[model samples]
Target: MLDLIASLLADKELDCRLDHPITEARAAFNRAIAEKKTGPIKRLLVEDAVLVTGTDSGVISGRDAQVEVWRADFAQAGRFVYVRTPRCVLPSEEEPIVTELGTWVGKPEKADGSEVRGDYTAKWREVEGKWKLEAEIFTTVKSRDALAL
Candidate 1:
């Protein structure tokens, strides 16, 4: 009984420690997007990070390429808002890899006043004590009728 209690306490402590870094990473990402600061976004990504977006069909590989895409998007965008919430955060036991399944909503500064909602899975790696995004795959949420052939 004592062993079980101690194990449970240790697990809880581990969870607490994991939450801080994950939450901070997410907050930093949101801030970067909101402020339109590509530098902060690049700092959060690994050199060979992969980004697959719902807007485009092509996969963006490498941090420099990803930043270039964001630069173009940011240039065309005005008064935009992007928000994401993590639904699940899974930390790997064998490697320093963490995967987060989340929902993202974006409202572009457009005349149509449309909002884009999607689900994303982001893989992060702890590089030199800092969590950096390694890869991300996004899937847009569409209506049933839209999927109908």
Candidate 2:
């Protein structure tokens, strides 16, 4: 699952980039939704996912659309680093599950030191002897300026 995610990040797939490991994504998404904050930024820590992020003001106004805007902005950024944490194996013996945590960091094209951040968790399922992303959830941590936008 991690390998597939790495490929997507490398290719910069705007949609369905984190679809692998579906369980983790869905868990994170559900948690964020439960937080129900007024701002567009909301987050949750799944069983094995960690959140590390930074963002610009563009996210605040988009509300539910923040993720969409981030994807577009990510492509426009000049300097960016996407980092992934090592995959972890769950303790339960019922199924073979893998969990991974990762983040995407982006620097503005013109600014000297402005940037955006995205953190995510991906879970993979071994279905029919294949590992694929079953769930994912992610959030962008933005700066005051980005939130204001």
Best by the TM-score measure: 1
Predictions: Cα RMSD each: 7.8, 13.0
Single out the weakest 10-residue window by summed lDDT for candidate 1. 140-149
Per-residue alpha-carbon lDDT of model 2 for 57-118, expressed as tens digits?
Answer: 22132223444444454455353433333233332246676555565444444555556556
TM accuracy, model 2: 0.34
* C-alpha lDDT values of all predictions: 0.75, 0.43
What are the per-residue Cα lDDT tens digits for candidate 1 across 80-118?
A: 567777765778779998877677878765524566777
The lDDT of model 1 is: 0.75
Output the lDDT of residue 139, model 1. 73
Clashing pairs for predicted structure model 1, backbone only: none
How far is 121's C-alpha from truth in model 2 (Å)?
1.9
Clash totals, every prediction: 0, 22
